[model samples]
Target: MKQLYDQRISCPHCGHHIFVSLDASEGDQDYYEDCAACCNPIHLNMHIDYAINKLELRVDADDEQVF
Candidate 1:
């Protein structure tokens, strides 16, 4: 399996599309990265579902995203 996966997400600040690199080996993670378009912070959350064998991601602004 690939350790890194490319995820496409929209920047909550400027509504621009951006691609982020996520590491699957970490299992679960939360981090912030600057948006390439808006130059604002983008919150990213990722989780691994071993049962379905898939990686789930959530992107938000400075607040937490509700499922």
Candidate 2:
């Protein structure tokens, strides 16, 4: 598996497409990045599935609530 990779995601606030760099070497991670278009903080949750050799990314706005 590649330690470093890039994924394209849409900003939850502005819906603008952007590329984000991810490092699988760090394992699962939770971070935030400012959206290029909307300038809102984007919550990024990364999960690595070693069994399936897959990386899953969840993108959302920081202010989102889960019900």
Best model per lDDT? 2
Leading candidate by TM-score: 2
**Clashing residue pairs found in predicted model 1:** none
Query: Candidate 1's residue-wise lDDT over 1-67, tens digit each?
Result: 5689987889998999988889999778999999998799998888888888888888888765689
Supply the TM-score for candidate 1: 0.83
Query: What is the TM-score of candidate 2?
Result: 0.90
TM-scores, all models, native as reference = 0.83, 0.90
Candidate 2 has which clashing residue pairs, if any? none
Please report how far candidate 2 places residue 8 from its true position, in Å. 0.9
Lowest lDDT 10-mer window, candidate 1? Answer: 57-66
Candidate 2 lDDT by residue in tens digits, 1-67: 8899988999998899999999999999999998888888999999999999999999988785789
